[model samples]
Target: MGSATVLTSSWFCVLAVLAVLGDAFLPFLPSGTLVVLAVLKTKETADAPFLLGLAVACASFLGDVLLLSLARRGAPFLRRRLARSPKTAASVRRVQRALENRTNRAAATVVIVARFVPGGRTVLDLAMGHLPERSRRFLHWSAVSAAVWAGYIVTLGWLNSHWFNTTWLSLAVSCAAATAISAAVARLVRRSRQLSVVAQLDEPVEAVEAA
Candidate 1:
């Protein structure tokens, strides 16, 4: 690939990194869509697509780590800030429990499967980071997840590029996919909250014997 082509090739990786970073601080960012479009544009070029994939993977992994670490570290401050409110604590506990139940193997499966599942990929790493497992083990799983995500998107793009001539279409489809994935995540959150409520209801309350 020529210099221009190489630069074009790298554009996807850059955008993917930005998506990861953006999603890190802002949960509403369309990270999944951006990653797909980026891969779609870069997959067919003579440029070194593998290099671009590597860059994207690294960026995503690091971004996830940063987000999770910050959240964990900032929890104390957040707890202090929301001290008077038990609601926030309950919500945090629910999120923590959901993430904790996802074992290393389950996380690996999620990372690979969510590559095409939009918001799922971004949340996977964040959830993984909150696990009680060793940091080294988490890193290993995260790296593998990133690589799998990149490879899946890149390969899909390469296959579709033959029939899809416009990058705009790729972006449009990615957006739609992201929207659907967001809906799915919303449903999952709702269900988790309901489950938490049910679990709480199962507890017994103490009573006084005499008044």
Candidate 2:
């Protein structure tokens, strides 16, 4: 089918929404790839990209909100489980402390950054429910994160479409590139967390030495 015909169809819209929404709950879902594929097919139409981006963004935001609400409702049970494991409880306490220490903007930035990290969105959203921040604040930042994520993926697909001749080639290249980027970001985040732990651990020793 032609780009316009495929992009304008009802099935496409439904599929796009489902892919984005499902990803919120199922981290393994290839929602980003599906979105990129959709954008790749929008080459012939001028308005298709905008409409698709908007729909994807709205669906993503809605999914985040729903996931957050579910997490909020289950927070008590989750807390109980976390408390049973000292390691897990400590990790939760650390995240809570970090979020509590940071300013609103910094915390929101963390939320936005988590959206791009593999499997980070689900974990972060769930943790936000138990964090000290209000739901309104999280929703606001999550909306921005959703929009940014949609735009980033859509733009990547659009650019790849112009760069490559074949749709499959564009999809493959873009997905590979996105995966590499996410891997690198995940590595950096892990490293940062380790360094923070090291610093925290050293603080007591340094204080003892000073005495």
Using lDDT, give the best candidate's number: 2
Per-residue lDDT for 155-192 in model 1, tens only? 55555555577877766665565567545644454455
lDDT scores of the candidates, listed in order:
0.53, 0.69
lDDT by residue (1-211, candidate 2, tens digit) is 6665864654655676698987766667788888888887666767777888899989989888876786677655455554554544454456556666667777787777777776566556555667635678989999999899888888888899999999999999999989887777656666674333212221111000000
Deviating ranges (above 4 Å) for candidate 1:
1-12, 75-91, 98-104, 107-134, 174-211
For candidate 1, what is the lDDT? 0.53
Cα error, residue 29 of model 2, in Å, equals 0.4
Best TM-score among the predictions, by candidate number: 2
RMSD of candidates 1 onward, in order: 10.0, 9.2
lDDT of 1 at 134: 44
